[model samples]
Target: MSNFVTLLVEDDALQREVLADVLKDEGFEVLECTTGEAAELIIASTGTELQALITDHNLAGKMSGTELAHFARDRHPHLNIVIMSGTTVKPMPVGTAFLQKPFSPERLLDMVRE
Candidate 1:
């Protein structure tokens, strides 16, 4: 089993559960949250212990996933970030990845493990 720790932020419960299950099945430790605010707190508290962050661009809070990604990048320069959205997202933060909605678990795994 891998020791990689990943943070997954998605407001949709079903989507969150599915992705979390997939990641956990693959031996990755997954932290899940429903809003950008919560995710920010986790990021701040966890520091570099978090290896990856996968979040939806349009989140439930004032801070969007893109904003969270930028915040995370500022703190954890080497953290892997994946922003997910059905619509096109322009100008994603530097050094972050984008995963479109309806993507396969394998694709997500690839991005996380990349």
Candidate 2:
């Protein structure tokens, strides 16, 4: 199996695809989702294979990224979570990372590598 696995949850179709492409370019096995509900289901079923999660704060579904992050952290404590947002909201939990939107692909790659 590949050494890196990443899940990307973003509501914007273009952004999601762009991010997925970047991760793929870096040799990560990437799973993409546009909503928190779908993200939750994917994580539940594939948490063991997931090395990291990249999500946006706002999503198309009822649940937000923060909710998903908390759930994923509870279920998979060792997983790395990175939350992105255009506007600042609440502070993230310790050990979790944040990336502001309008970020360069290089910055995103750096964050994922970290």
Candidate with best TM-score: 1
Q: After superposition, how far is residue 15 of candidate 1 from its true place, in Å?
A: 0.4
Q: lDDT, candidate 2, residue 103? A: 94
Lowest lDDT 10-mer window, candidate 2? 88-97
Q: Output the TM-score of candidate 1.
A: 0.96
- Write the residue-wise lDDT of candidate 2 on 1-114 in tens digits: 266889999999999998999889888999899999999998888747798999999999899998899988988888989999998858686578899888999999888877
Q: Provide the lDDT at 95 for model 2.
A: 72
List candidate 2 stretches off by more than 4 Å. none
lDDT of all predictions: 0.94, 0.89
- Residue-level lDDT of model 1, residues 1-114, one tens digit each, is 477899999999999999999999999999999999999999999866799999999999799999999999998999999999998888899999999988999999999998
Displacement of the residue 75 alpha carbon in candidate 1, Å: 0.4
Instruction: List the RMSD of every prediction in angstroms.
Output: 0.9, 1.4
